[model samples]
Target chain A: MHIVDGALSNEVVIAGSVLAAGGIALGLRKLDIEKIPAAGMLSATFFVASLIHVPIGPSSVHLILNGLAGLMLGWAAFPALFVGLLLQAVFFGFGGLTVLGVNTLNIALPAVLVFYICRQGVAARSAITSAVWGGIGGTLSIVLTTLLVGASLALSGDEFIPAAKLVFVTHIPVMIIEGLLTGFAVYLARKVKPELFAELTVSAEATS
Target chain B: MGHIVTSGPQVLVNAQVSGGNRLLDKLDPRTRIITACVYAVLIVSFKSLVVLSCGLALSLAAMQVTNTPVKATLRRMLAMDGFILFTLALLPFTMPGTPIFSLFGYGFSIEGLMKAIDIALKANAIILMLMVLVGTLEPVTIGHALHRLRTPQVLVHLLMFTVRYISVLHQEYLRLRAAMKVRSFQLSNSLHTYKSVGYLVGMMLVRSLDRSERILAAMKCRGFTGTIPLLDTMQFTKRDKVFALMVLFFALLLIVMEWMIDTTY
Candidate 1:
């Protein structure tokens, strides 16, 4: 889901930077300074988590877990996930620098969307119910992220329309993998540490 | 697709880049950050193949000067190319221009092909330059450098905290995986595999959250209010000034050459 530099038109790049800045600010404002430790550790944890490769068939796909991060952190996923992207770009050269904002927007916006759409469901009384909701949220986040990525590319030029379409189509399997993994992760969190979901809700509610 | 088992070292291995270039390392990190930003922006906006080729050559030259392993650096870049190759390949078919070739019923155009190459050159060059400049720094210095560059204080701190704990938490993650491996856990395409991996991640999140509480308590014990004090004191010395000026001169030369070529063409 990372868009490298020199791919986007100037207008798309500028728009992405502006919108991402706004999202980061909103996320930061929601996160109190005292919560920094938790946010940081969670952010690092997600970075580490993304390294885990779940085998789909002969190949493997690394976890994005943006939806899970959103469920855990609400709006704050924007900044935390942005940090993850930044590290990937710098250390791994997985994404480029100038397109940082666009990549951040593409990955994090759907995360915020997931939080809103599945927050209530993830808070369901039964672990199985919450897991189902988590699966839905996870699937939806990947679906929405693919769309945003396509839109950004397509908006840049008519030439990229096919590539944008391909981006979504190729990621379909990934969507299922992430959804299942997120579902089980949510189930475990629900069974062992229900408070994980509670913290996000309380914070989200208080902020709202 | 690197190994997940040794992710702590995987993330930090590039920090060894700092000692590779004495001249580059001597410059203030702020200079490198600013220079990379400006260079990337300039490279992205460039249209002429001549200009982009020069940018690529220049970045390649920087790599040579730094004693950076040419094979390893270019291999990472090749991986990036793999990511964008499909998109670039589509361009020749998608954009309308003079027909260069035909595949099935579709016509590939010269203009679209040129655009693809242009983008590829720009993308690769900027990434290479970024790796040589900003990517060579220790990750922690990047946080401090951004702070010095007036990045939002809270955001900088967030980056700092993330940088500080990525390795530690990665070690914790490895320990959990080791425990799983001890139980003869096999990663495969199955519900068992998915559930086990998910549980591993969940366990990681739960323990890290608990650890965070202890950290917050420890910070409060040490009278930490909101901000962690900046311990790094970076100075922009004469060498940094000289390097910034050299970068500026290089940018101006590229701009002048591009302008001249654009006008003539």
Candidate 2:
């Protein structure tokens, strides 16, 4: 769902940048000293994790792991994803700098949304429940991202509607793969170090 | 449409190509970054093919000035613009307008071809500008530029650390994958495959968190403060300002031409 540069209308691009700026600000405020290094490591982890490609058909896709990042980091996923996208745009030319805001918004907003929707469930007592929720989070992130990418393109002009639909259609396989991968990942984390998720639960309970 | 197909080794190879072109490398990172952002907007907003072509020509010149090798740059363009190419191929068949030509009894629209070409040109111009601008700056330079621009401190630090440790973690990932492959593990669309890859990523996460702890300790030992002070600062030179102004002037000219075309038509 990386919306390449010049793919979006100026209106969508400008609006995305504004919203992404707000997200970054909120994420920065939430980024405490303790979470800083963890955020950094997670950002790096995301950077590397995304490079692992899995074959689907003639073309291959890679793990976005934004769902896991949001499940783990909450709002901090904004800045973390922003950095990863920025690096990808700058270093690898995966996306363009012009559309970085749209790309970040498309990818990271779903992450934040998943955190709100599934973080609690992902911290559930039973590993099975946590894994299931994590899977849903992963799948939902891709679904939302593709929708946003499609919406961005479609809103650009009616001419792009077919292409936008094509994007969503192609992403169905990615959704399934990412869902299963995230389920297993959440399951493994629960088994190995339950505290990793326990922290979020405790923090949420404290805040509430 | 282009998801990440490149591998860890490719990422490692890309890490070595940090910014340092004679022309672009000399400009302040801030100037280059701002100009690129402005150029992106200008190029994307352009509706006229003629104006977009001018933008493309200027971007190409900038790429040449930055010493970006043409072949590698074109490959990057292909990777990034693959979806646009697909759209260009499909536009004529689906887009409604006067038919320009027909293939296999399918009529292609003149307006559709123009729109497709417009999108392609804009995409090319923006990518070329970015390849010369952002691509010619080191990661640290970008981080520092962000800092100097008074971006959020936490975000800048996050970007800096991510840039620093990505290569390290990538190497770790390669080793782990190598270990898995040695055991004859293959990536197939199966639950078993997903589970195993999940374990691999999970293990990497665990290691990364542990390393982050150690890294924080190491930094604290060195009297690390919350903010990293810039040891090497970039100063905006007169020449840099002149270059930025010249670019902006040309960009304005393109925008004006686009506006004129819109008004005249």
Candidate 3:
């Protein structure tokens, strides 16, 4: 889901940069002293999560887990993912610098959205119900991300419309995989560490 | 798509032209980062094939000047070309334009082909430039450069800590995964597999939080403040200015040449 440099038009790129700047500002404003270490650790976790490849068919796909990150981190997911993407860009050249703003928006905006939509259910007491909400949130985040990716491309030119649609189509399997993975993740968190969700909720309420 | 069991070392490998001309390396990382950004914006914005080609040439020339490995650069470009190739394959069929040719009752347009090539060239130009500028710099140097550039202090710190702990957390994750595997954990299409992987991620988070608490305590014990002072102070000297000016001149030349070509043609 990483949009490489030079893929977007200058106008779209600039627009994305502006929106991303706003998101970063809001994210930073919400990040208090106590949340700083958690932010770093979550960023590191997100970074390392990419190395955890899940086999699908003959190939494997690295976990994005943006949805889960959102559910856990809320607005802070912006900076957490930005750091991960920045390192990935610098270290592996997975994405380029010019497209950094757009890429960050594409990945993290959906995260914040999912956070708003599913954080409550994730914090709910019933483990199975929370897991289902987590699954939906995970799938929805990927779907939304793919749409944003497509919209970014499609908005650039009519020629990219096909490719933009293809981005969504290709990610269907990823959506399913991530959904299931996230569902189980929420289930486990609910079982073993209910306090994790509680901490996130408390921080979210404090910031809001 | 082979199994990447050792991703830690894999991420550690850089696209540098090993032990090359020290000229590019000597330039301040800030200079390199700025130049790379300029190169990307210039190439991405240019519309003409002539200008785009010139940008590509300039990027390639920079790579040669910096002694960046051609094989490694090509490999990275090829890796990203998957999506570019997909678009290239689809454009002619989907783009609305006069037919350049017809194959199996489908129209292939010359305009679409040119657009695809233009996009490809622009992407390659940026990738090569990044390979020359960023891939060569040390991660810490880049982080310091970002800090010097006055990026948000929080972001800079987050990036630094993430870079420092990636390998440690990665090792922890591997050990945990290995532990699970030793217990006959095989990832399959079953709900059981998903639940187990979810547990794995959950456990990792728990451990990461615990570790962060310990780390915070240790830092506080050392009289840590909100902002840790950077150790290496950077100064932009004559050499840095000279390199920056050279980059500026090259960029202006490309822009003028493109404008001239556009006006003349």
Candidate 4:
């Protein structure tokens, strides 16, 4: 989730900031005027999605929906998530300013994976298959992000084993929750907003 | 997380703490936001535990003088204590320095404990500054601050709408949960409930989109531009400059103290 400032090393924060900047640049390059509304809508949806809490053992985890964001906005999910997170950090202090880059990259990379995975599955003519891919993608993304956070902390001379174990164990329930949420979200999208799929297909075709 | 559900009293306390005071209320929203941001940066930049402690104490004193209730602040800090504990628990195990004590096959170091305390203090300071800013400033004023900060007009507008719609969405979520409860929907250890939640979210998204379109149309009808005009311009007075300078001076002083301690100790 959100890493507060001073939790990680300054090196990690700087590196994250650099990588996030690159991701934002890459994401912005593919923007089309028509996609602006989609981006806005997706950003708003991402903002709201974090509010719905799913109870875990001691901590409540909410649906990040980064995978769904990927499915909907494709590359644009980067900026959408970034902006959404920035607002959350600034307005509600959900996260920290220095760690913004790391959090965004952690979430957006998986979003990109979901986008590509969904693209391939849709091309294979199976919405359910795509949903499954989306679900797995969402779950793995969170796991990877947690691992990265752990690794970053460990690399900074923090006890690697305990932090790693804590992060990994804490995330198991949340990952399962994310997978379920992603699967159902994709299914619903396919049902109610079939045009979204069609638009993705059209965009893919246009790109090719 | 389940504890958050039982946090109604805590939330009420926090709300009351934030609701107190009219002095901060009188400042321009942009100025308040700038002050908050500056405070966050200054607090984070310092590595000394003492300075962080002092910063936190100063912030609390400001809150107290502004009539912010102690119970409210304590409740808010308690909610955040979970995260702080997580950070603290990691420090003694990971940080390197002269070992102070050994417990349960682990060595606790002075450096680690100090670092952890510093982190906790900085986090608290930032959170306190943010609470004061948000409590004092209106949402529209925040929007104006972002605009003044030269954030993207489109994104600012989106945020404006998003903030406006958040309450509506919260209400919708409550209604949905109530309806589910009325139908005797038992949420248990099953994937089915998650899918239901997802479906609900998807439906909400669609509704929100439709609502946003209507809002856009209405704005256009009223000759709304992409940018929202600020009701009051953010002007920096001599007093504002003096305040800003004082903050900077204290921040530098803290940084110096941290450096001296790190070197001498």
The C-alpha lDDT values of all candidates are 0.86, 0.81, 0.80, 0.68
Between candidates 1 and 2, name the one with more favorable lDDT: 1
Give each model a TM-score. Answer: 0.96, 0.92, 0.93, 0.85
Q: Write the per-residue lDDT of candidate 1 for residues A1-208, one digit (tens) a residue.
A: 6788888999999999999999999989887867889989899998888877888888888889998988888888889999988887776667888899999899899999999999999988888999999999989989999999999999999989999999999899989988988898898888888877867787789887
Worst 10 residues of 2 chain B by lDDT: B1-10
DockQ, all candidates in order: 0.69, 0.59, 0.60, 0.39
User: Which residue ranges in model 4 land beyond 4 Å of their true spot?
Assistant: A25-38, A56-60, A122-124, A158-161, A200-208, B1-21, B68-73, B216-232, B259-264
Best by TM-score: 1
Chain B TM-score, all predictions listed: 0.92, 0.87, 0.86, 0.83
Q: For residue B98, give model 3's deviation from the true position in Å.
A: 2.2
Candidate 1 per-residue lDDT over residues B47-101, each given as its tens digit: 8999999999999999898776576677778878887888899899999999877
Q: Please tell me which predicted candidate would have the highest DockQ against the true structure.
A: 1
lDDT of 3 by residue, A50-139 (tens): 777787777668889999888988888888898888766654556777888999999999999999999888888888988999999889
Deviation from truth (RMSD, Å), model 4: 3.8
Best by lDDT: 1
lDDT of 4 at A180: 77
Cα distance off (Å), candidate 1, residue B51: 0.6
Q: Local error of candidate 2 at B186, Å?
A: 1.9
- Candidate 2's displacement at residue A34, Å, is 1.4
By DockQ, rank the candidates, best first. Answer: 1, 3, 2, 4
